[model samples]
Target: MSSNPGQEGAVAHHEHESREHASHEDAGIGRFFFGHVPEGVHGGLKQYGLLAIFLAIITFVEFVIILPEDLRGSSIVIAPLVILSVIKFFCVVAFFMHLKFEHGLLWQIFVAGLVLGLIVAIALVLLFGVFRPTPRAFSEGRQQPFVHHVEEAPHYEPLVVPTPAPLGAIAPAPAAGAAAGASPGQQIFMGAGGCSACHAIEGLAVGALGPDLTHIATVAESRVPGQSAEDYIRESIVEPDAYTVTAADEGIDQDFQQGLMVATTSSLGLTDEDVDELVEYLMTLR
Candidate 1:
């Protein structure tokens, strides 16, 4: 039997409507996780809901990257997180805050504020020495950038601190072919160990992230009053939180993510003897 064109058109339209209704109902939490917005869902609620889903996905991915050891302090990780958050910030302002639908002038003002905030955040990261190039000395006294391969603050293995003479003992015997006066501890601090990344050592390195170690040997004992300079320095490396070194230059106690240094070292995969050697070299920093 031949179908009537009008009736067939009506039946097709009904099917389309049913499909659209199903899609709208499926725009649940699962859709949010995958960021699949329903085409049929329109109007203010749908638009804002999809934007919120995107924001949530970005935020969750950022948190996942941050919780891992290697990515937490990495600029490769940090830069993306910052950028994603910026996008989410704009979405919130535009949709939820109605900036997108506001007067042109009002939205421009809001966006200008956002630009200023982003610039300030970037400046602060730079001021904190997160992206600055730092010089590093290797085992053979060859100098290179502290983080050569990494864009900024990648996972760094402790410089291989060779066995050195004990802190209070005579100069230890170096391996037959070692660099003269370039003890294992010295190598680790200046080279693979990454000390020079955040510290400044006289005639050695000039890192700006942490307090200068030029006179760390001298001040180490006095800072804690009763702790030996050697002990204090070791504790500073192994337990930095034990003493929060205020940025006396700035006259403020800030909570910088500098804790990554301690976190990295705690699992530095170095032997006890190697650590002792590393400490010995720092003790000689005066």
Candidate 2:
């Protein structure tokens, strides 16, 4: 039997329409999940795979940058890490989130939200004085204090305490002067206080998170007007935000953010005597 040409044509056209409908459905689903793709761009698995690789490479670089202890401590390392983070953030938002394909009101809304968030962040930092630094303390003339070191002996000497004399017995005379020894403040700073974790003191603590305190004693007196060095140092230990130190004060090139130091003395479990001793020892730095 011979087929009709018009009937054959009709069947072919119907199959064509079915395929077109399927294609539209697939595209719609893609747009719903992965977002709309801009013209001239092949929003395919291959393109997304490449983007994933790029993001992975950036993350690896960031990880490697902080792997070294020296680089971790240097201020120069912060900028690159921040830049990479921003790049990653932008890429994820623009491509993965399909924000780049959006236009008009959507873009405006996004930009406005970003700006408002940044403003709020900056305001919070200022209100909390997180980056605020006290005035620089300049030292004009000051002498370095003497540090006493005792010679090593085979046996350690025991501390002696005077006993009360019997009713009829005579009391022993006290020694004229005590022997010079290591500073108690130095012991606490190096051992229990944990000041060395963020502060650097030449030949002692080697922390880089905070300012260098090699000559803090010489500059302490000049930190606050009319405030004595002892008072300033004590306040700094108990209330770290009372006087924040800048990168310039630490002789560094970067801007040292304040509030990185722990704000309370209770955090260090320091007592009034420990604070006094720590201040006294720091005063001897000059």
Kindly list the per-residue Cα lDDT of model 1 for residues 1-286, writing each as its tens digit: 2222332232223323433333223212222232323234344676777778888898898888788786678898889888988778766765576543333456557557868998999897786557653432223443344755567655545554333222222212222223466778876776556666666777766555677788777777688778899888878777777877777633545443457567645665667677799889878777
Lowest lDDT 10-residue stretch of candidate 2: 170-179
Candidate 1 vs. true structure, TM-score? 0.37
Task: Report, for every candidate in turn, its global Cα lDDT versus the true structure.
Answer: 0.60, 0.62
**Count of clashes, each model:** 4, 1
- Superposition error at 74 for model 1 (Å): 44
Tens digits of lDDT, candidate 2, 42-124: 34467678889999999999999999988785779999999999888877866676555443345557767998999999898
Model 1: weakest 10-residue lDDT segment is 167-176
TM-score of each: 0.37, 0.38
Assess the local accuracy of residue 107 in candidate 1 as a C-alpha lDDT between 0 and 100. 50
